[model samples]
Target: GREAEGDIQKGQKEKEEKEKGREDQEAAAGASLGEEAPCSRGALLSPSRKAWNPGPAESKLELHPLLNRWALWFFKNDHSRTWQDNLQLVTKFDTVEDFWAMYSNIQLASKLSSGCDYALFKDGIEPMWEDSRNKRGGRWLVSLAKQQRHSELDHLWLETLLCLIGESFEEHSREVCGAVINIRTKRDKIAVWTREAENQEGVLHIGRVYKERLGLSTKTVIGYQAHADTASKSSSLAKNKFVV
Candidate 1:
């Protein structure tokens, strides 16, 4: 009986020691896991769990805001659709970067099909002459030859846009409504539309500034035609209300 009891006591002690060994190994494994590098844990995490790291501040471009928010309109000639239906509002942009981004991505004025037009008007105003802000206004007409479409058209149009967004007109900038580039088979026309036709001083100043910016020769005379005269005219023979 005494011998049997000794054997049982030894077996019980061995079992307890094995259990202690297993517990110690488990505790050590947990400690090792806690001490592991962050990279190891990051690998197990989902993509969304990771923090967002923005690009370097110095490399990011700060966009320049323009004086006025402008809306760009494209008019495609369609026999089936009315004139109003053909005009589409492409987008409105208030920043210089955004404007260039849009301009660079779209077809150039010279590239648009004939009878089409590109109009840049102040936000909330339609490009039509009938718009309340434009009904009494006139445009400083720049008639471009067919040959000049490829060479000078784009440059002149870009300068016109820069003049507008840059507010190059100074005090008379308010008188300016927008500009239009009409692509035609016979001749492409560019014009700076102003808010008032009766204000002779403002009209002449805008025309002179526009012509100079366009790098037009002194001999090249551009005329201003009132919306009323244009609306009444049956053909291209609208009488010039003011000439510069």
Candidate 2:
């Protein structure tokens, strides 16, 4: 028993060390992200040696990897194209620096033309209501007024991105599958999609943390609607399963 306890302690220590190293790498990347190429997914994945150098023994470039590989999807409601064809995979990134690099290069949420959306989902999960990972899940939806688009849309979307990549939901992080921001003509929306809408506790916890991260007004209320619900009915008609 004592030997087993020692082994567990050693494992925990190793985990802590690994986490520390990851943070250090992310910090280094943040400091030098300005040098990265714009619109280069390759740069996001394979940062050049000129941008990072941790030590003589290590590789010329090392980046801080995230817990989950995420793919960014862009959707423009192109009337000429089918929905699937309209949605394009912009890029995928699994490192803090890559996320920052790609994000910096892209247009802000407020700047996206109406009927366009930006979605970041874990690799292998499609950013659609019909996606297997999303079909059973729901989203905590934050609807913004037309005016708020100019004032608050970009900031809130950035915060939502940071929350997902940072895993800010703690024990409920895995429940969060992805997030989306839609730019519309009159009203805009941002939603954090979770894996299981039936997991009331986990879903609610994510809602609370997400709302807090967005720095929403305490009087404001947001709603969570399952994909099953939203898929069957128009979003305006879907009933909220939960709210925060």
Per TM-score, the best of the predicted structures is: 2
Compared with the true structure, all predictions reach lDDT values of 0.74, 0.77
- Each candidate's number of clashing pairs is 0, 0
Clashing pairs in 1: none
Estimate, for each residue in 1-72, the C-alpha lDDT of model 1 and write its tens digit. 111111112244444443445435435433222232112212212122222221232114233456689999
TM-score against truth, every candidate: 0.75, 0.77
- What is the TM-score of candidate 2? 0.77
For candidate 2, the per-residue lDDT at 57 reads: 19
Where does candidate 1 stray beyond 4 Å?
1-61
